[model samples]
Target: MSRLLDEEGLPPGMLAPLDEDPGPARRLSRQKSAALVQAAVLAALDAPSPPPRSRRRHEWLMGGALLVVGAAAVATWHLSRRSDSLAPVETPVVAVPAVVEPVRPEPVVPAVDSERAEVAGVMRTGAEAGGDVERAEVAGVGVMRTGAEVGVARAEPDVAGVGMKQTTTGGTEVGVPRTTPDVAVPSPSAKLRGTEMLPSAPAPEDLLRRANGHRATGQWKAAEALYLRVIRTDPQAMSAYVARVASGSLRLEHLGDARGALRQYQEAQRGWPGGVLEEEASHGVTEALRALGDRDGEARALESFLARHPDSPHGVAARTRLREISGR
Candidate 1:
């Protein structure tokens, strides 16, 4: 083979062929095997051996390993999904209802009657002002007289700054003064202007405004305080005193103060003797006294006031009330 190989020489390529040649079948010659037991291997040459496992076994092992890994991944995914499905549900956040504080509505103070309104205007003009101490004392004494029995009428001052005897109209009435004398009075509009637009005093509307504001704003204590201050400053403060009387009288179930306020109205009647307000005060006294469980006293006052002031605007109303009281 060496001689035959020498005859063919070598092939033409970048790499020179080895001196030994491995044919298509990697087999040794007879002399190279049994006969070649004694043969010498000049160059060490080797051929690859067959695989240890069969091809079918290798394919089955790879396929089984892939199937196991796929099954494990699918099992893990399924377990995770099951865990998620069974997980506790999240509760929706329910916004707690905002605790709304209730807004208390303001109190309703009755509109000051026009008669009281006019008297309030006169009072604002400082009608018959006295020393503060004397005015306060007079007001206090009037309040104290309610619980006491009827006694001698206290001495009061006439509008002329002179002391006058307080008479109780014991005889035929001398009649009420509703209209001023024609010579002393201005025109209708002028008289109204004189009464309403007092340049020398604060407007009665201003006092009414304050009283209404205090009452409407649910400020009972504040309203009471303002009423008291106004009545004290001007003892003839008709609307303010009347408003206080009304306010005090309304709480009759809780505060039985109508009698005290009724006495105050009586004092105001004396302080401002000759206006439509006097009749109104008398009526207010009648109503308040009746509320105080003294219907008889109320009836007598109403009769006296009505008998004295037949032409008063409220005269008809007073008569109606008297009739009702008499029937009762």
Candidate 2:
């Protein structure tokens, strides 16, 4: 009975003897202890064992290493394919010919008919003038003559179909007919002679006369141009002096250019001091000063003019201007 109660998970002191009369409370207590012991055994049998820490960590590391190796293999394969696709391809080389330029033909110069005829006439005249004539063929078509006086004549044909004749003086002449008749040829000496015959420039007096003609015709600019040409041609001549005076008068009277007139008059005065035109230049200076509204300068110039040329035709006007400046 004690063994049975022990197997049923009962306390040793709770077991009763089998010969004693058992009550219902004792039986119910045994049944309840058996049921509690069976429940505890079932719960202990159903619980799972705890896993090992080192094995779990090792498994996770192996899986991560496999994943990394797979990714590296995939990346290496992709890079290799990309490099192959971008590789350069070789092309065949072809040889090309260099460009050649066409050559141009030289121009052909035609010979003159008049020169050819004159040369032929000269050659015929020399042959008839009673000299020993030794004839030789020149360039297969022309005749070369040797005379009593040492002379040689030569004719040659060029690529342009033109014939050339040369004459030498002891006494020989050769002529070849020209193919073209329209062209006229002049020698270098003739060109120089023509250049020497060109007309010379006009004289200063002629330029002055032209200037006077233009002035009379009311061509003021043209007249001035001619006067300037005369002055430039011969500045020290009487024509240039007259041009200065005339230019000053024109500027003063027609152009109303007091400053330009004064400049001309002053130049004339400086160029020919105390000359026959001194009275005119001095009076022109006074007039220019008056036109410019320089009363003091005009007064001084007038006094000087009167002192210099008292017997002049403009002396009365100079004295009157001086008196006006002095408030007399």
Per-prediction backbone clash count: 2, 0
TM for every model, in the order presented, reads 0.32, 0.39
Tell me the lDDT of candidate 2: 0.50
Model 1 alpha-carbon drift over 4 Å, by segment? 1-208, 234-256, 311-317
lDDT of 2 by residue, 1-328 (tens): 1344344553222343333222324322222333444344433454322443554455456555655664555555455556647753431112111111111111111123343355456545443343211221111222221221111111111111122221100100001112221122222222223332223555444454555556555776676666666555445556556667667766676667777778777877777787656777788888888888999999888988888877554666778778988786
lDDT of 1 at 207: 40
Model 1, range 239-312, lDDT digits (tens) per residue?
Answer: 43344343343223223456565655666565666644455566667766777778789889888888876655
Residue clash pairs of candidate 1: 31-36, 32-36
Error of 1 at 63 (Å): 99
